[model samples]
Target: MRVLMVSWEYPPVIVGGLGRHVHHLAIDLAGMGHEVTVITRRPSGTDSLTHPTTDERSDGVRVIAVAEDPHEFRFGTDMMSWTLAMGHSFVRAGLRVLAGDQETAWVPDVVHAHDWLVAHPAITLAEFFDVPLVATIHATEAGRHSGWVSGSTNRQVHSVEWWLANEADALITCSESMRDEVNRLFGPEEIQVIHNGIDVDTWPFAPRPQTAGPAELLFAGRLEYEKGVQDLLAALPRVRRTHPGTTLTIAGTGTQLDWLMETARKHKVTRSVRFVGALDHNALVAAMQRCAAIVLPSRYEPFGIVALEAAATGIPLVVSTAGGLGEAVDDGMSGFTFQPADVAGIATAIRKTLDDPAAAAVRARRARDRLTEDFSWREVAERTEGVYLAAKRRVRHAYGRPTIIERPLPERDPGK
Candidate 1:
């Protein structure tokens, strides 16, 4: 089957989990004898589609990057702008390919859009091309840091997300918690839960080299105000006083970087805090392996992909009982939990893992076992393919028949 994958970010231009998810999904889909064509917004200096740069053409998959108009709003950063831009680009790219005899001319049987970033294009392609559309809502605006949408800008973002969820043929999310939230937001059974997964082999399996010390705690991801990084910083002061040599390693760069740095300095624990801004995949895995435990102090989280990553890497985690993250981190088993904004609770959870190495090790192994059994990219992709098949059937039933083709063909090209 031919599939069109739409996303705002991909490798070399990723901001978070969405890009990584799309990249892995496309690769897996292509490997499964499905022709996958990915359309994403181009980073600056990336030669745009008039000269369309092909990032890769592995197996039967192709990637097309289109330059998008970067009109920035106060709150709209990488995701919002790129999503809007990707929408426009997807329509444009679809038209360009449909009009020609390009390598991607076979046309796609299904349009799979990742997150709200590609929702615009996902909707447009579904209507304009009359194909099955499947959207994955990684998280909701309400679930991100529990912030209120007051202004026009905030409303616009929320509006886009709502539109995508409603317009798509089927909805996918990363956890049962998110599925429940989406169901409540859009009515029951509106969203399907497909937990996030990681490449187990890529992550560091063993802990980082350590000395007799207090312990090291990790918090990785975007440095946004809603991410509750400040809470982690506040917790650090307390944890440090109790465990003398405790150190906090924050990996990842975001809008709240300066404030977090200032918070560390103000708490007089600057020496114990290391702001290792933005690690690549390998670096992050290594850091996770070394830390005593990983903490996600988000105000609200949809699925907590990082928690899964930590679990897969045999790293115990401490996640806030925020939104969907609670579903991912099995409190007292895979990891521990605390109230969303409780600084002392966050500190105490980290201390638990540090003080009880034997128990922590047990949880870490269980976490790894759980990931291996349920959350591998291969499993995720296979489940996602089932979603695609269901979506195709729904579209077929709605339309009464396939319009452009008789059946889903094996591939556009018949012979080698």
Candidate 2:
């Protein structure tokens, strides 16, 4: 199957997990002998053109980077303008591919759009080509803001998300929890749950020394309010009371860094909490190897890929019972789960793992086993391919011998 993937984030311009997810999915799909073409926003400061630039990877994936507006984004309107500009570029790129401008160009059988950022373009291209649009909602605006679209920006984003779900032929989410949320919020006719996977071999598995100095707890993700980093800081004092030598290491940066430091000072656990801004893959693997356990205390996690990474590294894991984090780990069997924003519960779970090395090791082993057996990129790609096939079948039945209409590409407003 030939697939066209639309996303706002990609390598060298990644904001979060969504970019990494798309990168892996596209490459893996191409490796599976499926023709995959990815259309994403080009990184700023590069050669910015009004047209899209194409790059072919050794793994057989073709990436088309759509140049975005060069204007500074100061307000919500500017951001929307940029998104619309990207959509316009995507439409133009699709038209070129359909017209066979290049020797290797071929029309995509399925248009797979990731998240809401590229929803506008994905919907437009799918409709223009009269093909199936498969949308993957990585996270929802309402979920990120704790079940509320507080501001105009959030409301608009939520509305776009609703429209994308309504427009797509098939909806795909990263977890069962997300599938349920999409059903409740958007009421999509059908939704498929595909677990986000990780490359288990990428992380080295080495047991910490039996006689390590202090039990190091690691939190590796954005230090944001919804990520519950502050809650983890609050739980540190309690964790220290049980195991005084225990220390916490945070690996990531976000708007809440200063506030998190301030929270640590207020809790009088500043000395024990080390804010390590961000670590690359190798450094992160070292950090994980050094740490006794990994904690992800998210208030709302669509799918906790970090938990899976920790599990793959054979590290004891503790995550909040929020959204997909709970589904990622089996409470007590593979890892521990605490209530969202529950400081005591978070501390207790951490302390339990620290207090019992044997039990913690057992849980870690179980998690590693599960990661190898279930959560792999190959498995994820296979499952995703199934969705694409189903969507193709639906499109074939609904629009038998559909005709493509060559319409003029919509004009983009850079100053909207």
Q: What is the C-alpha RMSD of each candidate to the true structure, in Å?
A: 9.9, 7.3
Backbone clash total for model 1 is 2
Tens-digit lDDT string for candidate 1 (250-274):
9988866777788888878889888
* Clash pairs for candidate 1: 208-290, 252-278
Q: Give the TM-score of candidate 2.
A: 0.90
User: lDDT of each model, Cα atoms only?
Assistant: 0.74, 0.82
Query: RMSD in angstroms, candidate 2?
Result: 7.3
lDDT string for model 2 (1-416, tens) is 98989988888678788988998899899989998888886775444664437655546788877665566653334666666766787788667755465675577788999999899888887877678999999999778776666566667777888888877888999888899888877877589889888888898677755654678889999977789988898898888887878889999988778888888898998889899898998999888887888999998899988888888788899999988889889999998999998999999899888888788888988988888888889899999999888885243323222122233323321211
Which residues of candidate 1, in runs, are more than 4 Å off?
A: 44-52, 69-83, 98-104, 145-147, 207-210, 392-416
- lDDT for 212 in candidate 1 is 78
